[model samples]
Target: MFAALSAIGAFIKIPIGINSAALDTVPALISAAFLPPVYAGAASLIGHLSSSLYAGFPLGPLHLIIAVEMFLILFVFTKLHQAGRNVWKWIFFIVANSVLATLPFYWIISPAFFVMALPGITIATVLNAGIAIVVSPVVERVMERVRTHA
Candidate 1:
Protein backbone atom coordinates (compact mmCIF):
# COMPACT_ATOMS: atom_id res chain seq x y z
CA MET A 1 0.00 0.00 0.00
CA PHE A 2 2.69 2.46 1.03
CA ALA A 3 4.89 1.43 -1.88
CA ALA A 4 1.99 2.05 -4.22
CA LEU A 5 1.53 5.50 -2.73
CA SER A 6 5.22 6.06 -3.20
CA ALA A 7 4.84 5.00 -6.80
CA ILE A 8 2.15 7.66 -7.15
CA GLY A 9 4.57 10.23 -5.78
CA ALA A 10 6.80 9.31 -8.70
CA PHE A 11 4.35 10.74 -11.22
CA ILE A 12 5.92 14.19 -11.30
CA LYS A 13 8.86 14.71 -13.63
CA ILE A 14 11.58 17.20 -14.44
CA PRO A 15 13.65 15.95 -17.29
CA ILE A 16 17.40 16.52 -17.13
CA GLY A 17 18.92 15.61 -20.45
CA ILE A 18 18.50 11.86 -20.82
CA ASN A 19 17.88 11.27 -17.14
CA SER A 20 14.92 12.73 -15.29
CA ALA A 21 14.06 14.00 -11.86
CA ALA A 22 10.78 12.19 -11.45
CA LEU A 23 10.64 12.71 -7.68
CA ASP A 24 10.62 8.98 -6.99
CA THR A 25 13.54 9.11 -4.59
CA VAL A 26 11.59 10.31 -1.55
CA PRO A 27 8.97 7.64 -1.89
CA ALA A 28 11.76 5.10 -2.11
CA LEU A 29 13.25 6.61 1.02
CA ILE A 30 9.87 6.49 2.68
CA SER A 31 9.76 2.83 1.81
CA ALA A 32 13.20 2.39 3.31
CA ALA A 33 12.36 4.26 6.51
CA PHE A 34 9.15 2.42 7.20
CA LEU A 35 9.59 -0.97 5.58
CA PRO A 36 12.46 -3.34 4.87
CA PRO A 37 15.31 -2.43 2.55
CA VAL A 38 14.08 -5.01 0.06
CA TYR A 39 10.71 -3.28 -0.09
CA ALA A 40 12.42 0.06 -0.64
CA GLY A 41 14.38 -1.43 -3.53
CA ALA A 42 11.27 -3.16 -4.80
CA ALA A 43 9.27 0.04 -4.61
CA SER A 44 11.97 1.98 -6.43
CA LEU A 45 12.29 -0.68 -9.10
CA ILE A 46 8.54 -0.98 -9.56
CA GLY A 47 7.75 2.73 -9.26
CA HIS A 48 10.49 3.88 -11.58
CA LEU A 49 9.92 1.32 -14.30
CA SER A 50 6.14 1.44 -14.08
CA SER A 51 5.73 5.21 -14.24
CA SER A 52 8.54 5.70 -16.71
CA LEU A 53 7.17 3.00 -18.99
CA TYR A 54 3.62 4.32 -18.73
CA ALA A 55 4.81 7.84 -19.50
CA GLY A 56 6.82 6.59 -22.47
CA PHE A 57 10.21 6.81 -20.85
CA PRO A 58 12.71 7.45 -23.62
CA LEU A 59 15.97 6.44 -22.02
CA GLY A 60 15.24 2.79 -22.75
CA PRO A 61 17.82 0.68 -20.87
CA LEU A 62 19.11 3.73 -19.07
CA HIS A 63 15.98 3.64 -16.96
CA LEU A 64 17.25 0.37 -15.59
CA ILE A 65 20.48 2.08 -14.61
CA ILE A 66 18.66 4.77 -12.66
CA ALA A 67 16.44 2.16 -11.05
CA VAL A 68 19.49 0.29 -9.78
CA GLU A 69 20.92 3.53 -8.50
CA MET A 70 17.73 4.38 -6.64
CA PHE A 71 17.57 0.90 -5.19
CA LEU A 72 21.16 1.05 -3.92
CA ILE A 73 20.73 4.43 -2.29
CA LEU A 74 17.44 3.57 -0.61
CA PHE A 75 18.66 0.17 0.47
CA VAL A 76 21.69 1.70 2.17
CA PHE A 77 19.43 4.26 3.79
CA THR A 78 17.32 1.51 5.29
CA LYS A 79 20.39 0.22 7.10
CA LEU A 80 21.10 3.73 8.31
CA HIS A 81 17.55 4.10 9.54
CA GLN A 82 17.84 0.83 11.39
CA ALA A 83 20.95 2.18 13.07
CA GLY A 84 19.18 5.42 14.00
CA ARG A 85 21.71 7.55 12.16
CA ASN A 86 21.40 10.99 10.64
CA VAL A 87 19.49 11.21 7.38
CA TRP A 88 22.01 13.65 5.93
CA LYS A 89 24.09 10.62 5.03
CA TRP A 90 21.66 10.29 2.18
CA ILE A 91 23.53 13.10 0.49
CA PHE A 92 26.61 10.96 0.44
CA PHE A 93 24.70 8.02 -0.94
CA ILE A 94 23.06 10.19 -3.56
CA VAL A 95 26.37 11.46 -4.81
CA ALA A 96 27.95 8.06 -4.58
CA ASN A 97 25.11 6.41 -6.44
CA SER A 98 25.38 8.94 -9.25
CA VAL A 99 29.11 8.45 -9.50
CA LEU A 100 28.78 4.70 -9.53
CA ALA A 101 25.93 4.67 -12.00
CA THR A 102 27.74 7.05 -14.29
CA LEU A 103 30.44 4.47 -14.71
CA PRO A 104 30.39 1.83 -17.53
CA PHE A 105 28.43 4.49 -19.38
CA TYR A 106 31.71 6.32 -19.58
CA TRP A 107 32.74 3.99 -22.34
CA ILE A 108 29.30 3.19 -23.75
CA ILE A 109 27.31 6.43 -23.46
CA SER A 110 30.19 8.91 -23.93
CA PRO A 111 33.58 9.65 -22.54
CA ALA A 112 32.10 12.81 -21.03
CA PHE A 113 28.89 11.20 -19.86
CA PHE A 114 29.89 11.40 -16.21
CA VAL A 115 31.09 14.96 -16.52
CA MET A 116 27.85 16.22 -18.07
CA ALA A 117 25.24 14.24 -16.16
CA LEU A 118 26.88 13.97 -12.75
CA PRO A 119 26.14 17.50 -11.67
CA GLY A 120 22.48 17.48 -12.62
CA ILE A 121 21.87 13.96 -11.32
CA THR A 122 23.61 14.69 -8.04
CA ILE A 123 21.68 17.90 -7.57
CA ALA A 124 18.35 16.21 -8.23
CA THR A 125 19.24 13.25 -6.05
CA VAL A 126 20.37 15.42 -3.15
CA LEU A 127 17.22 17.47 -3.41
CA ASN A 128 15.13 14.32 -3.31
CA ALA A 129 17.15 13.05 -0.38
CA GLY A 130 16.51 16.30 1.46
CA ILE A 131 12.81 15.96 0.87
CA ALA A 132 12.99 12.37 2.05
CA ILE A 133 14.80 13.40 5.22
CA VAL A 134 12.13 15.93 6.05
CA VAL A 135 9.33 13.40 5.70
CA SER A 136 11.02 10.29 7.10
CA PRO A 137 10.05 10.78 10.72
CA VAL A 138 6.42 11.18 9.89
CA VAL A 139 6.55 8.13 7.70
CA GLU A 140 8.19 6.19 10.45
CA ARG A 141 5.55 7.17 12.93
CA VAL A 142 2.73 6.35 10.60
CA MET A 143 4.20 3.00 9.66
CA GLU A 144 4.82 2.23 13.28
CA ARG A 145 1.17 2.85 14.07
CA VAL A 146 0.11 0.71 11.16
CA ARG A 147 2.38 -2.11 12.19
CA THR A 148 1.28 -1.94 15.80
CA HIS A 149 -2.36 -2.01 14.86
CA ALA A 150 -2.09 -4.46 12.02
Candidate 2:
Protein backbone atom coordinates (compact mmCIF):
# COMPACT_ATOMS: atom_id res chain seq x y z
CA MET A 1 0.00 0.00 0.00
CA PHE A 2 2.78 2.41 0.85
CA ALA A 3 4.62 1.37 -2.29
CA ALA A 4 1.51 1.93 -4.37
CA LEU A 5 0.95 5.36 -2.87
CA SER A 6 4.58 6.21 -3.42
CA ALA A 7 4.26 5.20 -7.07
CA ILE A 8 1.16 7.33 -7.42
CA GLY A 9 3.10 10.23 -6.00
CA ALA A 10 5.52 9.75 -8.89
CA PHE A 11 3.21 11.57 -11.24
CA ILE A 12 2.87 14.56 -9.00
CA LYS A 13 6.16 16.30 -9.59
CA ILE A 14 8.03 19.45 -8.78
CA PRO A 15 10.68 19.74 -11.43
CA ILE A 16 14.24 20.41 -10.38
CA GLY A 17 15.92 20.33 -13.75
CA ILE A 18 17.96 17.16 -14.33
CA ASN A 19 17.64 16.15 -10.71
CA SER A 20 14.70 14.14 -9.38
CA ALA A 21 13.05 14.78 -6.03
CA ALA A 22 9.30 14.37 -5.62
CA LEU A 23 6.37 13.50 -3.38
CA ASP A 24 7.44 9.88 -3.69
CA THR A 25 9.92 10.50 -0.91
CA VAL A 26 7.14 11.11 1.61
CA PRO A 27 5.66 7.65 1.30
CA ALA A 28 9.10 6.13 0.94
CA LEU A 29 10.14 7.70 4.21
CA ILE A 30 6.95 6.51 5.85
CA SER A 31 7.57 3.00 4.62
CA ALA A 32 11.13 3.21 5.75
CA ALA A 33 10.09 4.31 9.20
CA PHE A 34 7.59 1.48 9.56
CA LEU A 35 9.09 -1.48 7.72
CA PRO A 36 12.26 -3.45 8.16
CA PRO A 37 15.37 -2.41 6.25
CA VAL A 38 15.12 -4.72 3.25
CA TYR A 39 11.47 -4.04 2.60
CA ALA A 40 11.85 -0.34 3.10
CA GLY A 41 14.88 -0.24 0.84
CA ALA A 42 13.02 -2.05 -1.93
CA ALA A 43 10.01 0.21 -1.55
CA SER A 44 12.14 3.31 -1.71
CA LEU A 45 13.90 1.99 -4.80
CA ILE A 46 10.60 1.27 -6.50
CA GLY A 47 9.29 4.64 -5.43
CA HIS A 48 12.20 6.42 -7.02
CA LEU A 49 11.88 4.46 -10.24
CA SER A 50 8.15 5.02 -10.44
CA SER A 51 8.62 8.72 -9.78
CA SER A 52 11.13 8.98 -12.58
CA LEU A 53 9.25 6.91 -15.14
CA TYR A 54 5.74 8.06 -14.30
CA ALA A 55 6.69 11.70 -14.27
CA GLY A 56 9.37 11.51 -16.97
CA PHE A 57 11.15 13.89 -14.68
CA PRO A 58 14.78 12.95 -14.69
CA LEU A 59 15.28 12.85 -18.49
CA GLY A 60 18.07 10.25 -18.58
CA PRO A 61 19.73 7.26 -16.98
CA LEU A 62 21.27 9.56 -14.44
CA HIS A 63 18.06 9.00 -12.52
CA LEU A 64 19.45 5.61 -11.48
CA ILE A 65 21.83 7.41 -9.21
CA ILE A 66 19.06 9.64 -7.96
CA ALA A 67 17.12 6.50 -7.10
CA VAL A 68 20.09 5.37 -5.07
CA GLU A 69 20.03 8.71 -3.36
CA MET A 70 16.36 8.30 -2.51
CA PHE A 71 17.07 4.89 -1.04
CA LEU A 72 19.86 6.33 1.05
CA ILE A 73 17.71 9.21 2.15
CA LEU A 74 14.92 6.92 3.25
CA PHE A 75 17.38 4.63 4.99
CA VAL A 76 19.29 7.34 6.82
CA PHE A 77 16.40 9.63 7.63
CA THR A 78 14.27 6.93 9.22
CA LYS A 79 17.28 5.86 11.23
CA LEU A 80 18.02 9.41 12.31
CA HIS A 81 16.07 9.45 15.55
CA GLN A 82 16.46 5.77 16.35
CA ALA A 83 20.16 5.90 15.70
CA GLY A 84 20.49 9.24 17.46
CA ARG A 85 22.75 10.37 14.67
CA ASN A 86 23.63 13.83 13.48
CA VAL A 87 22.37 15.37 10.26
CA TRP A 88 25.57 14.69 8.37
CA LYS A 89 24.14 11.97 6.12
CA TRP A 90 21.25 14.21 5.23
CA ILE A 91 23.67 16.98 4.37
CA PHE A 92 25.93 14.63 2.44
CA PHE A 93 23.24 13.08 0.18
CA ILE A 94 21.75 16.51 -0.53
CA VAL A 95 25.09 17.72 -1.83
CA ALA A 96 26.19 14.42 -3.35
CA ASN A 97 23.15 13.69 -5.50
CA SER A 98 23.57 17.03 -7.23
CA VAL A 99 26.90 15.82 -8.49
CA LEU A 100 25.99 12.12 -8.87
CA ALA A 101 22.85 12.80 -10.90
CA THR A 102 24.73 15.15 -13.19
CA LEU A 103 27.87 13.17 -13.83
CA PRO A 104 26.53 11.72 -17.07
CA PHE A 105 25.73 15.21 -18.17
CA TYR A 106 29.30 16.06 -17.40
CA TRP A 107 30.42 13.38 -19.84
CA ILE A 108 27.83 14.14 -22.50
CA ILE A 109 27.18 17.84 -22.03
CA SER A 110 29.74 19.71 -19.95
CA PRO A 111 30.81 20.61 -16.43
CA ALA A 112 28.95 23.89 -16.90
CA PHE A 113 25.68 22.01 -17.25
CA PHE A 114 26.24 20.14 -14.00
CA VAL A 115 27.19 23.40 -12.34
CA MET A 116 24.02 25.08 -13.59
CA ALA A 117 21.74 22.33 -12.31
CA LEU A 118 23.42 21.95 -8.93
CA PRO A 119 21.54 24.73 -7.19
CA GLY A 120 18.13 23.51 -8.24
CA ILE A 121 18.97 19.94 -7.21
CA THR A 122 20.20 21.12 -3.84
CA ILE A 123 17.07 23.15 -3.26
CA ALA A 124 14.83 20.28 -4.28
CA THR A 125 16.57 17.75 -1.99
CA VAL A 126 16.39 20.16 0.94
CA LEU A 127 12.71 20.80 0.31
CA ASN A 128 11.97 17.08 0.08
CA ALA A 129 13.93 16.40 3.27
CA GLY A 130 11.97 19.09 5.07
CA ILE A 131 8.74 17.57 3.85
CA ALA A 132 9.85 14.09 4.91
CA ILE A 133 10.68 15.37 8.39
CA VAL A 134 7.25 16.97 8.71
CA VAL A 135 5.04 14.23 7.24
CA SER A 136 6.69 10.98 8.33
CA PRO A 137 4.88 10.68 11.64
CA VAL A 138 1.49 11.36 10.10
CA VAL A 139 1.98 8.71 7.49
CA GLU A 140 3.38 6.27 10.01
CA ARG A 141 0.41 6.75 12.34
CA VAL A 142 -2.08 6.42 9.51
CA MET A 143 -0.41 3.25 8.32
CA GLU A 144 -0.47 1.78 11.80
CA ARG A 145 -4.17 2.47 12.13
CA VAL A 146 -4.83 0.90 8.77
CA ARG A 147 -2.74 -2.11 9.65
CA THR A 148 -4.56 -2.65 12.96
CA HIS A 149 -7.96 -2.26 11.34
CA ALA A 150 -7.00 -4.77 8.69
Candidate 3:
Protein backbone atom coordinates (compact mmCIF):
# COMPACT_ATOMS: atom_id res chain seq x y z
CA MET A 1 0.00 0.00 0.00
CA PHE A 2 2.71 2.45 0.93
CA ALA A 3 4.77 1.68 -2.13
CA ALA A 4 1.76 2.01 -4.42
CA LEU A 5 0.77 5.33 -2.92
CA SER A 6 4.26 6.75 -3.15
CA ALA A 7 4.62 5.55 -6.71
CA ILE A 8 1.42 7.37 -7.59
CA GLY A 9 2.69 10.47 -5.84
CA ALA A 10 5.85 10.40 -7.96
CA PHE A 11 3.77 10.77 -11.11
CA ILE A 12 1.65 13.59 -9.71
CA LYS A 13 3.77 16.68 -9.92
CA ILE A 14 2.71 20.27 -9.69
CA PRO A 15 5.41 22.45 -11.15
CA ILE A 16 5.61 25.67 -9.19
CA GLY A 17 8.66 27.07 -10.96
CA ILE A 18 12.26 26.29 -11.69
CA ASN A 19 12.84 26.23 -7.96
CA SER A 20 9.72 24.78 -6.39
CA ALA A 21 8.38 21.45 -7.52
CA ALA A 22 5.28 19.98 -5.91
CA LEU A 23 4.08 16.43 -5.46
CA ASP A 24 1.14 15.08 -3.54
CA THR A 25 1.88 14.53 0.13
CA VAL A 26 -1.27 12.59 0.80
CA PRO A 27 0.52 9.26 1.09
CA ALA A 28 3.13 10.53 3.49
CA LEU A 29 0.51 12.46 5.42
CA ILE A 30 -1.65 9.38 5.70
CA SER A 31 1.27 7.26 6.78
CA ALA A 32 2.16 9.77 9.45
CA ALA A 33 -1.45 9.93 10.54
CA PHE A 34 -2.03 6.19 10.74
CA LEU A 35 1.23 4.37 11.37
CA PRO A 36 3.85 4.55 14.06
CA PRO A 37 6.31 7.38 13.47
CA VAL A 38 9.22 5.06 12.94
CA TYR A 39 7.31 2.88 10.55
CA ALA A 40 5.97 5.84 8.66
CA GLY A 41 9.37 7.43 8.47
CA ALA A 42 10.96 4.25 7.18
CA ALA A 43 8.24 3.71 4.64
CA SER A 44 8.40 7.30 3.47
CA LEU A 45 12.15 7.11 3.08
CA ILE A 46 12.12 3.81 1.21
CA GLY A 47 9.24 4.82 -0.97
CA HIS A 48 10.87 8.09 -1.94
CA LEU A 49 14.21 6.47 -2.58
CA SER A 50 12.59 3.89 -4.79
CA SER A 51 10.71 6.50 -6.74
CA SER A 52 13.76 8.69 -7.20
CA LEU A 53 15.84 5.79 -8.45
CA TYR A 54 13.11 4.59 -10.80
CA ALA A 55 12.67 8.11 -12.14
CA GLY A 56 16.37 8.46 -12.93
CA PHE A 57 17.04 11.18 -10.40
CA PRO A 58 20.44 11.23 -8.74
CA LEU A 59 20.36 8.53 -6.13
CA GLY A 60 22.78 7.70 -3.28
CA PRO A 61 23.36 10.78 -1.14
CA LEU A 62 20.30 12.64 -2.39
CA HIS A 63 18.15 9.69 -1.41
CA LEU A 64 19.59 9.74 2.06
CA ILE A 65 19.00 13.46 2.34
CA ILE A 66 15.38 13.17 1.25
CA ALA A 67 14.87 10.22 3.57
CA VAL A 68 16.04 12.31 6.47
CA GLU A 69 13.70 15.09 5.47
CA MET A 70 10.74 12.75 5.15
CA PHE A 71 11.58 11.19 8.50
CA LEU A 72 11.62 14.58 10.16
CA ILE A 73 8.37 15.64 8.57
CA LEU A 74 6.61 12.41 9.47
CA PHE A 75 7.97 12.39 12.97
CA VAL A 76 6.87 15.93 13.68
CA PHE A 77 3.45 15.46 12.20
CA THR A 78 2.88 12.30 14.16
CA LYS A 79 4.01 13.93 17.38
CA LEU A 80 1.77 16.92 16.77
CA HIS A 81 -1.21 14.69 16.09
CA GLN A 82 -0.55 12.76 19.24
CA ALA A 83 -0.47 16.06 21.12
CA GLY A 84 -3.86 17.05 19.69
CA ARG A 85 -2.53 19.98 17.75
CA ASN A 86 -3.46 18.70 14.34
CA VAL A 87 -4.19 21.55 11.96
CA TRP A 88 -1.90 24.39 12.89
CA LYS A 89 0.94 22.08 13.78
CA TRP A 90 0.73 20.49 10.36
CA ILE A 91 1.02 23.91 8.74
CA PHE A 92 4.12 24.63 10.74
CA PHE A 93 5.47 21.18 9.96
CA ILE A 94 5.00 21.62 6.26
CA VAL A 95 6.67 25.00 6.17
CA ALA A 96 9.59 23.98 8.28
CA ASN A 97 10.04 20.67 6.50
CA SER A 98 9.90 22.20 3.05
CA VAL A 99 12.31 24.99 3.82
CA LEU A 100 14.71 23.00 5.88
CA ALA A 101 14.75 19.92 3.68
CA THR A 102 14.51 21.24 0.15
CA LEU A 103 16.50 24.47 0.26
CA PRO A 104 19.91 22.92 0.63
CA PHE A 105 19.28 20.51 -2.20
CA TYR A 106 18.01 23.18 -4.53
CA TRP A 107 20.69 25.73 -3.73
CA ILE A 108 23.67 23.45 -3.43
CA ILE A 109 22.97 20.19 -5.21
CA SER A 110 20.52 20.93 -8.00
CA PRO A 111 23.10 22.97 -9.92
CA ALA A 112 24.88 19.73 -10.66
CA PHE A 113 21.84 18.56 -12.60
CA PHE A 114 21.58 21.80 -14.56
CA VAL A 115 23.76 24.82 -15.07
CA MET A 116 21.06 27.28 -13.95
CA ALA A 117 21.30 29.01 -10.63
CA LEU A 118 18.72 27.64 -8.27
CA PRO A 119 16.38 29.72 -6.20
CA GLY A 120 17.41 30.58 -2.69
CA ILE A 121 16.56 27.86 -0.22
CA THR A 122 14.15 30.16 1.61
CA ILE A 123 12.16 30.87 -1.51
CA ALA A 124 12.10 27.26 -2.67
CA THR A 125 11.19 25.98 0.75
CA VAL A 126 8.27 28.35 1.16
CA LEU A 127 6.94 27.63 -2.30
CA ASN A 128 7.13 23.87 -1.81
CA ALA A 129 5.77 24.04 1.71
CA GLY A 130 3.00 26.35 0.61
CA ILE A 131 1.75 23.81 -1.86
CA ALA A 132 1.91 21.01 0.72
CA ILE A 133 0.08 23.14 3.28
CA VAL A 134 -2.71 23.86 0.84
CA VAL A 135 -3.11 20.26 -0.26
CA SER A 136 -2.52 18.25 2.90
CA PRO A 137 -5.57 19.32 4.91
CA VAL A 138 -7.96 18.36 2.20
CA VAL A 139 -6.25 15.02 1.83
CA GLU A 140 -6.23 14.55 5.58
CA ARG A 141 -9.93 15.21 5.89
CA VAL A 142 -10.69 12.71 3.18
CA MET A 143 -8.47 10.08 4.75
CA GLU A 144 -10.10 10.65 8.11
CA ARG A 145 -13.48 10.07 6.61
CA VAL A 146 -12.32 6.92 4.89
CA ARG A 147 -10.76 5.54 8.02
CA THR A 148 -13.85 6.34 10.05
CA HIS A 149 -16.09 4.63 7.55
CA ALA A 150 -13.85 1.62 7.24
**Local distance difference test, each candidate:** 0.73, 0.67, 0.61
lDDT of 1 by residue, 1-150 (tens): 656865776787777776667676678777765688888777877777776776787668888876777677667777777787764566556756667767767777897866887877777677777787788788778878999999
The alpha-carbon deviation from the true structure for residue 12 of candidate 1, after best TM-score superposition, in angstroms, is 0.9
In TM-score terms, candidate 1 sits at 0.79
TM-scores of the candidates in the order shown: 0.79, 0.69, 0.63
Question: In candidate 3, what are the lDDT values of residues 79-145, reduced to their tens digit?
Answer: 7776878676667665666555656666656745333423443443455445656766787799889
lDDT of model 2 at residue 98?
A: 51
Ranking by TM-score: 1, 2, 3
Give the C-alpha lDDT of model 3. Answer: 0.61
Lowest lDDT block of 10, candidate 1: 87-96
The 10 consecutive residues of candidate 2 with the worst lDDT sum are 81-90
Per-residue lDDT of model 2, residues 1-150, tens digit only = 777877887767776666545666566656656676556656777878987787665458867766776676566655663464536645654665455655667767788876787787667667766787678768768978999999
